[model samples]
Target: MNFEVVLTCAVTGAGDTTGRSKHVPVTPEEIARDAVEAARAGASVVHLHVRDPQTGKGSRDPALFRETVDRVRQSGVDVVINLTAGMGGDWTPAKDDWAMPGPGTDMIGPDERLAHVRDCLPEICSLDCGTLNFGNDDTIYISTPPILRRMAALVREWGVKPELEVFDLGHIRFAKAMLAEGLLADPPMFQLCLGIPWGADQTVETMAAMKAQLPPGASWAGFGISRMQMPMAAAAVALGGNVRVGLEDNLFLGRGVLATNAQLVEQAREIIERMGARVLSPQEARNRLHLRGADA
Candidate 1:
């Protein structure tokens, strides 16, 4: 069991969740407020994803990203900022014309995907390890090995820690290969994303198995979606890994209660303390992940 754990609150995600909950931050002002609140509530880090304020859909606008991140940084909150580099990879082929991208397809080049990271220079950014059939449809999230290699190189050059996101066993294999190739920074960080549709199930067995495959001395965290969120936090801590929580992966604090990001962070902290493990502060988390914050 891990006595020291870093709790990350994924404040807002690039998902179809905005319509489900009004609590989901849509505007840059709201996103920044939730991020600061999560940090103040004992989250060591905040994983951020901007949205279209007018439509409440996932967006990759650098201007929106800039506004949200700048507000958080200027808020004087002590939290590790983790931007999502997982956008611009969705590819839904047209029904009649499979050769062309469909309406939901949001494909872009690697450099364009990393535009926010290059501009914001957050302490950590995510790199989805591989491509997989997202959801229960023909839509596939595209992240080829070649594209990953190029993005990894650029993120390294920018001096931001890449939180390698692994969805399955094969993703873990590719992550290990990237480590062998010396593309990632020393003491790499990983986030075991579980319980997404068609990805790894939200079960302790899968979390344990994925945690076992991680590189030695690597820092890792695990999170489950929807109802399994808190359970996965306890499970991850028991298995010697960190935990993540917040509106990104879950919206309910209970069976019918909608949750805010701060509430989720508070709940996660309570769980960690109850397990005889203490939640790490942002500075402590940075020390473990070898992250250099903006203040540093």
Candidate 2:
């Protein structure tokens, strides 16, 4: 078992949960505050995604990302910031013409997607390795091979570690291919995102299968959405991997119990401690992941 675990708090995701729970941070200030609080609550890293303050929708705006990152850095916290480069890839086809994108489509080139990474120079940024049906019918998330390669190369160029986001088995395969092609560095980091519809299910069998497929010596974490958040964190820890938790993946502390980012981090920390493992500090996590400080 991995005795020392790195816990990541996903401060606010691109999910439309703002109306469902008022705790989801919408503005840059709110997002930064939650990230700092989560770090103080035992999160070694904070995965971030900015949302439109007025509409509560997901955004890929570099200005918003800069504001949030700046606030977090200015707070004097030492937590690792893992920004999401998984935006600008939602492709919902048009009803009349399949080639044309519909109202929900937000697809863009690789450069636009990583604009924030270049601007912020975060220590870590995610690169979704494959395209898949995102949610309901007709909605697809398009992360083509060429796009991923371009994004990965840019991430390397920026001197930031790529947290390869794998939502399914094929995505893992693509990640390995990218590694073989020299698009990623050694000891690549992965996030086994389970429990999303049309992707991998939240079960031990699925987690074990995906974990087994990871490259040897790769540092990885796993997370489950909704009610399976805590359960998946425990599973990941027990299976010799790190864990992720927060409002991004789950909103409730218990049945109908709304949770803040700090509370979720604390809850995961308690579970890790009770399970005979230690939650790593940000510096310790950086060392384990072979990352220099963001300032470096």
Candidate 3:
């Protein structure tokens, strides 16, 4: 397998990881700074998800996205910006006899979910291809086929590269169907999300299976949460795929060693290099992924 790998740093995920690790970027300024740092540390791309400034929780607010993107652009880094269009899909079961939404449900239509991406128009935006049982209890990620189709169509219309995100085998199948329907543009890109609870297991076998399922000529990357990050990085490279890492997926440089996003990116770059792989620069990644230029 060729070793031309591209590293993507997930700057701040829409999870409760901030509270778990103080290194997780919270404010827009902090997130942007982290993105620049990750670029300096050898990440060609930065996947961003903005949080509410006051509460430090995940948010779908377009203004928050505006501030975060503006800050990252002003930093003058060459890293490609990948905004999250995966929010507003959380669904918590109803407490009062399953008739209404419970405490943490934030489900909404596809358009509402992609509002930030439409407004910001980042170089790339994620499109979750399918839904599954997410998190601990009573939570179901509600990405039905119709919703995914609508989101994919919208993403294509907006002239943004949709990073098809797959958390399980079924999601990959769904993504392929979308491709067959001409919803996704040419040379489709995918992100295999591993180790999420009730999702695909973070094993070498699973990664290989998912990678093999991608459409012919597809450009793809993979990430694993928590302790699986480094192993999955190596696995992806070994399987002729790209890799991603960041505090959003893991909090430690090692056991009990707190890590920043830059630290994680640096580690990933080292691993890729040691595996006889050359890490792609931002421009190279842009070309490989068919992403728009900074000025575009």
Candidate 4:
């Protein structure tokens, strides 16, 4: 097991989870508040996704991102910020004509997809490595090679680290190719995304398999959705990797018990401590991962 772990709390995801949990932050103020609270509860990093306050849906609006990041920065918390660059790739084809776009389609070019990342300039922004059938529906998340290369280059140019989000082995393979092409910087960062449909399963074996494929000296974290969140975090720790947790992935602190972002971070911290691992501070994480730092 790794002696030191960087714990990340994904404050609020763009999923349909607000109705189920009142603790889910919807507005910039709420998201920022929870992110600060989570940091105080022992989260080294707070991964963020802006939501439309009126509709409680995920949004890629740069204004919303700016407000959220500003609030977090001004809150006096010293945690590292990580913004999501995984939106604007939803594609739900029309039933009648597969050739035409559908109601759920919100596909855009790489530049537009990274609009919020450019607007916020967080220390880390996610880059989903490939396309996948999202949520067992007609919806598919697209991130082709050309688009990923461009996005990686742009983030590198901006001095923002791209957290390569790999959902499966193939995604890891492609991410390796990107690294080979010199699109990613040294000591590449990775997020092993699991439990989503059509992606890798939420299990120790799966996380281990995916972790084995990462490039040497890469900094990585792994997370599983729903009930497997904490288990996967423990598994990640045991496998010599970092951990990610929050309401963005799991909603319950226990069976029939709803969780807030801070609560989730607290629980993950407890697990890490019980396993005899130290939770790294934001600066420690920055130094260990070779990040561009919080100011960047």
RMSD of each: 1.3, 1.3, 1.5, 1.3
Task: Please give each candidate's TM-score.
Answer: 0.98, 0.98, 0.97, 0.98
For residues 1-296, could you state the per-residue lDDT of candidate 2 as single tens digits?
77999999999999889999989999999999999999999999999999998999999999999999999999998899999999999988899999999989998999999999999999999888899888877989999999999999998988899999999999999999999999899989999999888899999789999999999999999999889999999999999999999999999999989999999999999999999999999999998997757224
- Total colliding residue pairs, candidate 4: 0
- The 10 consecutive residues of candidate 3 with the worst lDDT sum are 287-296
Write one digit per residue (lDDT tens) for candidate 3, span 1-296. Answer: 54898899998898888778888899999999999999999999999999999999999999999999998888878789999988988888678768788989998999999998988898899988887888779988889999999999998998899999999989999999999999999899999999999899999999999998999999999989888899999999999899999987899999999999999999999999998898999998888888876324
Each model's C-alpha lDDT? Answer: 0.93, 0.94, 0.90, 0.94
Clash count list over all predictions: 0, 0, 0, 0
Q: After superposition, how far is residue 254 of candidate 4 from its true place, in Å?
A: 0.4
Model 4 C-alpha lDDT per residue in residues 61-116, reported as the tens digit of each score = 99999999999999998999999999989999999999988998999999999998
Q: With candidate 2 superimposed using the best TM-score fit, by how many Å does residue 122's alpha carbon deviate from the native? A: 0.5
In candidate 2 the C-alpha lDDT for residue 219 amounts to: 96
Better of 3 and 4 by lDDT: 4
Model 4, residue 8: distance off in Å is 0.4
